[model samples]
Target: MTLASDDKVLILFRHAKAEQVYGKADHERSLTARGRRDAMAAGAWLHEHELGPELVLCSTAVRTRQTWEAAVDGGACGETVEFDDSIYSGGAQTVLQTVREAAGEAQVVMVVGHNPTMAALASGLSEGDGSSAAHECLAAGFPTSSIAVLRYAGPWSGLDIGTAALERCHVSRG
Candidate 1:
C-alpha cells in the first residue's frame, strides 16, 4: 500500500543500557537504574517534541521491554506495544522488514530495539539532508536510548537506503 507523499515517519530507538549479569542470558538481562532513567528521559523527549508514535514495535528482550515500560510510564507514547521476538536478534534488513509490515494507517511508527541493527538502519535510511547535527550524532555512534527520526514519502514497504531524510537524532542523558 503506497502512501501519499510526506505521510510517513519512522523513529528508530535503541534500547537503554542493561546490567551485564555474568550468567544471565543476553535476552534476559534487565536494565540498570541508569538505564531506566535514560529511558524515561528518551520518552520525555519524544513527548516534548510531539513525536509520540502511534504504533510501537519493540524487541522482546527483558531490557527492551523494560525500556519501553519506562518510556510509556513517562508518557512518551501511547498504549499498544507489539513485542516481537525477531527484533531481539534481527539485523538491519530484518528491522526494515518489520517496519514495512507495520499497519498501513499508522502515520508514526517507533521501533525499540538494540544495535548495531538500529544504528545501521538509521544510517542506511538517512539521506543526510535533514539536519547536520543529527547526521553527525548518528555517525558518531548509536548510544543506548538514542533515537533517529526519519521522514519520507512512500509506503513502508518501499523504505530503502537513502530514501528518507534524517529529521533529527536524540540521545538520552540520564
Candidate 2:
C-alpha cells in the first residue's frame, strides 16, 4: 500500500499485554505493570515526535483502552477517543472498515487493537525494506505498546490497495 498523508494517517497499535486473570472475562482483562510502563513509553515516544493523532479509535477491550489512555496521557493529541466494540476482536478487514468510517472527521487516526490482525493489516499496507522487518515483528507477535505509522494518500472513505505507505514503526520493551 502506498501511504499518503492525503488519504489518511493510520497509526496502528497493538494493545499492551494483559495480566492473567483466572476468573475474569477475556474482554475485561487489564494491563500488566510492564504493560503500563511500555504504554507510557510508547506515549512518550509519540509525544516526543509530535505524532499525536486527530482522533483515536480503540477497541472496547480493557487492555486496548488502557494502552491508549496511558500512552496519550503524556502528551496532547486534541482528538476524540471512542471505544468501538467491533474492534474488540476485529480483523484487518474490520479495522479497515472502522478507519474508513472515521477517516472523514480527522486528519490522523490511531487504532488500538490486538495482534495477528494488527500485524496482518500492517503487512498488507506496508511496502519496501522495513516491510519484511515489520512482518517479522508482527508474526513474532507484537509486544505490548508497539506502534506502526502508515501514510495513506487518498480519501479515508475510499481506501484501497497501495493506498498506504509505511512511514515508521516503534516497539517499546522495558
Q: Candidate 2, residue 7: CA error in Å?
A: 4.9
For model 2, how does the per-residue alpha-carbon lDDT over 44-159 read when each residue is reduced to its tens digit?
A: 88887777787888899999988888786655263788889888867888988988887575778888898777777877776443455655655566666788887776678876
| Model 1 lowest lDDT segment of ten | 1-10
Candidate lDDT (C-alpha), each: 0.86, 0.77
lDDT of 1 at 10: 88
Model 2 CA deviation exceeding 4 Å by range: 1-7, 76-78, 127-140
The stretch of ten residues in a row with the least summed lDDT in candidate 2 is: 127-136
List the candidates' TM-scores in order: 0.93, 0.87
